[model samples]
Target: MAEALVDLLAKVRERSRGLLLRLEGRYTVVGDLHGDYATLQRVLNEWPPPYLFLGDYVDRGDKGLEVVEEVFRLLLEGKAAVLRGNHESPAMNVDGGFLDELCEKLGRGCGAVYKEFEKTFAALPLAAVVNGKVVALHGGIPLGENMRPAPLNRLATLEGDLTIPGDPLAFQILWNDPCNCDDYLPSPRGPGAWLFGREITKTFHALHNTRVVVRGHTYVSAGCATHHGGSVVTVFSSTAGPYRKTKPKIAVVSDGVEVFDLYTKSRAACPEDVDLLL
Candidate 1:
């Protein structure tokens, strides 16, 4: 409920945030919300705050405004932060219909209303370091100027405004995917999104001195999935849009990653099943 979110919208305007967040302690890694307010409420009720929301809060479903507002409210509360997802940007919003949905609600006032949302989206961090162990983000590692995996520290320099349409590190961080392949492959999601391989994840771990990467973007029917032999985990939190009827999941990061079934309300089995990029 976040106290209806209207009372907090004004507060959101007064706020500005960072590009990369360093978070400690245990927090639940919630995946792409995609406007499923019902599922978001369920996650909060079950798991509570101290959450890392891998973005895409809007688009491709109803209740986008509610989801975004609730997320903004949580950020204002100081216990949670969201990573920018590709869908959080302008192109995807226009494609995914969130802009139109927002337009219908605000009409001629759309510019002002959307600007607040846009500014908030622009300020969303691109990545988070969880307890200095696992790396959680909306997507996979970004390629450097040499078209290779960039230095881990480069994340802090990213201006994650969600409007960089080129192959910039921030854009890749929000759009890339990890795959079973041996190296990087051009993502069918199109230009900026690349499908990275096991070595990429392995090298990423070594370079960052981190153990694993937890991310969201692609949908997995089981609600949770492990790629590159458990080095990369993807969790999906919404059962709406194209992911309907599937189990929505959250990866709880504590001493280790524990996948929770939002639909079944139970701890999920370790999933080796690949998502096939569906």
Candidate 2:
């Protein structure tokens, strides 16, 4: 298992992926799982990848480790890609209960497993661009100079493992949330994170040369929510732990975007139930 993890890490790093993972094809954009393995498995049984998982794989739920393993398995198989959510860092794992779960499950042997996961997490791309139109990320964009939204291409590349959320751009990309205002606002999540507005989303799309922003960070009761007049889509695909009340969903993106109601066994049975998206 250890050897396989090392090999997977090598394969992931060996790729020429920079800040964005560029792909041209249809994909199922999943939201934060937070270790909800059952929902993840069920969704996979139905939806056909390629899947773009918007991070937050570990922590919170009961099967974070299993979730990570399964996601990586799909990734290695070339069926999926993953983004780095706020919880992917060590600081988050400690607070979000993944560390406790790891210790309890693996006893003293969890350290090496965690080290590999940490390294794997660091190599994860912060965002993914689908068909050069829709942008999927764990969080939103970062604030540029003058505290404005930065150009997506002008961002600096990381030369080391991001064991922690120390880098400003990386931090925001993994922690920031969207809102309904006209500019950036302070986020209750923390000092590093911010709640951006509609224009900010528009500005980000303009600067990044993308039309839509699909991200996962906050909880939405419907399992999906749209901000910035549908420029931002937040999908929350979890029905475990503290998120039992939320309905889990995924964004199936091709020429356009459609929200698949995961609770339904057959997507065709309820075609009209799909949420509105541009």
Candidate 3:
């Protein structure tokens, strides 16, 4: 069993390396990783590019450094890109014990990794426009009427200055989640704000002429959710288990959308049972 797992990791590393040389399509979407290096390894190994990691690569699990290194390589080698998540720019420094624990796991010799993670976080975009058909972000759209593509373009190529507008689009990009309506709700995490509803997502799709707004932030144990006639599909890659007992899932996008549950080793089309959001 040990040998098989090692072989799997090696193959994944090779496949990730292959991404350096070539890629196709505008992008492939990844759900929240939550620092699961094993799942991240399997994803890179099993899937091809071009792919976009929807963020939350750190915290909530072990091997955060491994996750960071693989993704950093992918970004530097042009195999993939990333968007910011709440975890990447968490609400408070007081809540980062997990990051410190990750540091411990990676050990004291990993000062370079610590620096690398900081750099990677600095580079992550708040959003991306793919094939002009999809607008993706770590979270859904934010509140306010002035939201536009300019912010997304700016975010995609973010640089040195970390600016926060009173209505900073970056904050919304990482914190927004479409809920029942267009309203600002007090952030459960405190100091932060939460904007819930489909208005911004709809505006984004229409503004960009994209059909879907893809996101990750809220956890979906079943993998993903599609709303507003597929206008938005929120995906969660981290499986609903503490660790090894449950299998991770992938949000497979093609003609429409499907969930490939690693646990069941089965593929199912988008849920037909749920109501398409307003």
Candidate 4:
């Protein structure tokens, strides 16, 4: 496992360095990783470049520290931009009693690792701009004046107090989802909307004057799901299985502000995976 992680990190560094230098345009957005290192590795290897990870780098799997470290390296190399998913927040994890468990899993004498984790988490961007379209955080539409994606852009600039709630942009960026969907409802059991229905998505797009919004927070059987007049798309990188599944989906972005998916293997349901990475 350690060797594999080392190799993955090395590959991420190399690929990210090259990709950052040459690629420009909208970013290929990936869903929550949840510490599934192998799945993340496979996607990175198959299609890398001009990508962004939509938070949840730790928890639900082993190697959370390694995941953050390698992701931090990617940020440094400029290969990708990261968003602060709900799971990345220490306060949220602490309230849920997962912080102590995670600390135990990480073992004692891991202060440096913990500090580094906090630092990297602090540095994640709260939202992204694909062309003129605004993709603001976790789930549900932003509430009040606090929910706008403009301030969330500061997430890319912050390196301290990543978990504090003083900055409206801080928490809202990872917690807000588009609220105009009908078919998909926000998960009653999770943070933010279980699913932002299609209705909410259409309204949001109309209000924002953008064609699409991208997000990740819930699990979708098909690896990717869309709603709101196809205005909002959710991409799930982790497959459903006791361990892992085979059909991993990735998004690729073009220079023209278009996003589509790059499937691991040919699947019958979708003739071809559309690029939805922007």
lDDT of 3 by residue, 148-201 (tens): 332354443333444231235566677666664553444564354464546655
Give lDDT tens digits, candidate 4, residues 54-154: 77777665655556666766765677776667777666555533355456755664444444445445544556555556553454444334322332224
TM-score of each: 0.91, 0.90, 0.73, 0.68
lDDT tens per residue, model 2, 183-205? 88888787788888877887888
Stretches of candidate 1 exceeding 4 Å from the true structure: 1-15, 159-162, 165-167, 273-275
In candidate 3, which residue ranges exceed 4 Å CA deviation?
A: 1-26, 90-98, 106-116, 145-151, 154-160, 163-167, 182-192, 240-247, 253-259, 263-266, 269-278
**Which candidate number has the best TM-score?**
1
Note the residue pairs that clash in candidate 3: 179-197, 228-277
Looking at candidate 3, what is the lDDT of residue 184? 40
The true-versus-predicted C-alpha distance at residue 45 of model 2, in Å, is: 0.6
Predicted structure 2, TM vs. truth: 0.90
- lDDT value, residue 181 of candidate 2: 74
What local distance difference test score does each model get? 0.78, 0.78, 0.57, 0.53
lDDT of 1 by residue, 173-272 (tens): 8888888887788888877678889888888888878888888888877777888888888889898888787788898886457788876768887578
Kindly report which residue pairs in candidate 1 clash with one another: none
